[model samples]
Target chain A: MNEYFSDLFSGAKSLLVGLSVTIREMFKPVVTVQYPREKLEITPNFRGHTELVKDPETGTHKCISCMMCQKECPSDCIRVKGEKREGVKGLALVSYSLDFTKCSLCGTCVEVCPTAALEYSQEYELAGYSSDEFRFDLLKRLEER
Target chain B: MTPEAAKQDKHTFVLNMGPQHPSTHGVMRVILEMDGEHILEPEPVLGYGHRIQEKMGEARPWPGFMPNTSRMDYLSAMIYNHGYVSLIERMTGIEVPRRAEFIRVITDELNRIQSHLLWLGAFLLDLGAFTPIMYTFDDREQILDILEDVTGSRLTYCYHRVGGVARDIDEKFVERTRAFIARLRSRFKPIYYDLVTSNIIFIKRVKDVVSFTPELARRYGLTGPPLRSTGISYDIRKNEPYSIYPEFDFEVPVGTKGDCLEVYNIRVAEMEQSLRIIEQALDRLPEGPFRNKIPRKVKLPQGDATFSVETARGELTYYLVSDGSDVPYRLKIRVPSFSNLSVLQELCRNMLLSDLVMSLGTLDLVIPEIDR
Candidate 1:
């Protein structure tokens, strides 16, 4: 009886302390949102990953595929094919493919680009079915809506 | 005179604390010279299992190299991903899309809760409380499920990319996460307070014991949950304001006494704060590109840069140097657990050998993070 009474009082005290605090928290404002009902505003400096930037003037990328991105990529996710053109003075890009499966998104390639054509777009969703699907070609990235 | 000088003799007992001992958590060896049960001089022996991560970083390309960061601190792999991705983004000057930030916030918070839950369970176990472990896991399983659903890996998730996140959130994933967060909050809070906090044994063991002052906290460069507990309202998410943390409404819990109980209290409070941050992120989640547009064929210019992110353990800093090469010239990681472990020498000295376990556990030292 003595132990039971003590236990009850302690329990009551504990409840008072815990609930009163939680009650205070209730009025201050909820920290969580319904999520699907609403949306969050991402900061300007948020880092996601690398993407191909579109040229504002020519409606084309400046990637002549010098293979600087491929050479600088630590993960070797980037695979590029470049050849000298008859008329073009610089090397022209025939193909550029990025394997998302192995890409760490470190931005080594983007930062290294002298053309400033490669930009971080903050578009993050890049899951795929297989290694092949993960490989992104230049056409889709450059021309994507 | 020589005989009189020789009388100044003190006996020492050399004791091996870990590397495999239950208290050290993961492969930490501390040699203690003791006067019976009380530690006289404790020398921390490191490099029992040193993972050469920095060397690995030097070899791998920037984007491909991030998998190794998650492996360093295995517990908070999501936040580890968050840290590394943030650094790469900062160096490269890329911005994550609004939607990507929200997912990062949500996922990272889940990781924080997972870390704290594990800490609570482990800390209790260090104090000889077994039942709490089972209870913690029951709560943790739900979180693991949510994490595994999205990342396709449970423990070490390479979720974040340097430019953005790796995957998009489906309706099912978001719904399940919301449900799990609510359920775990209700369950864990009640059980933790009732089973652990209310227990007189626990209170007696933890309260007014192994106290760390704020001066000491700063001196040792302690960050994360323990640093907040010492009456310091320094949270990197709030102070530094990364991602979409500026929009979130949360409180950084401060404890008057920097004891084990205070650490416990702070972590519990932090779990709530992380929940709040998650809520704010979820509510304001944007719709757009999940990844940023950086062209293929990448290289960074010659530069030396330092990056700091708030990991669950503490402040994880990465210093990178590039010679305009594909590989980094030098890679250095300032891990939280390593600096946090320095304070343990002062804490455990002159205390009973048994309390050392509780002290170490409360600090939440991950050995790989320490050695790396």
Candidate 2:
């Protein structure tokens, strides 16, 4: 009978100890941020999607259409089209399309760009109704910017 | 009744346990032959999460395979990144900066703590405790925030590069990490101990239940915490001493009895050790270039090298064969979960169905890691 009470006391003690943790935590502020209503504060290092950097002086994209990013891309998601303009020395950008569906966000494209044309945009809300929306024309986006 | 008639009269049924079950962790199906609540035999069915990653390795360049490593073990992706990069670094005899090595160790240990925390929560959730997971997630969110500040992604991080880390850590990263360590030590540790470990119901469910002997663990080739619970003290970090682990002073916590409770205790103890490693790494962090100047197209000489690292799950081995080309000739990944999950067939025989869940939870099998 004495042993039974000891067992009961120990069990209750353990139960109280466990409950104490939850009870203390109850006063702590809730960690959950209501999604859709509020968004997370993103860090500077967040890699969302690849974008073409616009040259401030030229008011045009810095992407010389070198095809370096296309070659460096692991997923084969990037496609660059460039044509030599009349009497122009280097290739001019026609369209630089990136398929967001296939891009793995490894940051290799940005790292490998010689002219520093590629940069990661902090656009996290990338959801769309159709797959076609994910295929980004970076040259056009740069023009809009 | 005759023996044949008695055998015919025996009632045994098969129950499918997963493929969509939350407790399975990922797309894993288990065929359990049972007589009432007792499991007679449990056959694990894999391959639902298989992406033929090895074939993809051959198709892409050396650095291209970095992103795929994280998908295999998403919980502890940094360790996988370390393993893959370390393998290639070994094959090519590239010099990784001292600072980079320390950074790798720090990030890997941080990743480990988060992985173990998630396991602690999920394991309890499997055992019908819901509140513990919420507390764990609160702790985990801090870890994710710290990791995302530098690594750029939360779950599937491709942080490590061929020679070193993709980016360098700043003063803020180090300061934040130290602050996190203090918070974890002062605030979180006691709560975890009091809430889960000291609880009588949790102890009653796990202690002395589903225990495995050292010989049985060895026979099944179990590594990591499961093997350590059997009192083998066989940690790849200590025994092998890869990267900067030799510099850190931490004890390899072992359990006397290889039970579910022991597994739980060892993982919790491991989190403390990981914190110690991280603190030491942060203190000893050197100043140097984070990454060496390497060619965009990595062309390796004809050779094969095998590198193994102690990930959160267990020993994750990467074997890379370079045939003097940008792409690998053959890349093989030997994941820990594949071997860890294999022991379930032997361990689960004649055990109660409810206890089987406890055993599975303790093993810490990540299904994508297994299927990959």
Please give, for residues A1-145, the per-residue lDDT of candidate 2 as tens digits: 9988987888899888888888888898877889999898899789889888878898888887889889878899999999989976699889999999999988889988989998889898888899999999998999899
Model 2 lDDT tens row, B140-215:
8889999999988888889998778999999989999998999888755578878888788789889887878898
DockQ of 2: 0.78
- The lDDT of model 1 is 0.77
RMSD of each: 10.6, 2.1
Interface RMSD of 2: 1.2
- What residue runs in model 1 are displaced by over 4 Å at the alpha carbon? A1-145, B1-9
Give candidate 2 misplaced runs (Cα > 4 Å): A1-5, B1-8
Collision pairs in model 2: none
In model 2 chain B, which range of ten residues has the least summed lDDT?
Answer: B1-10
Please give the lDDT score at residue B34 for candidate 2.
Answer: 78
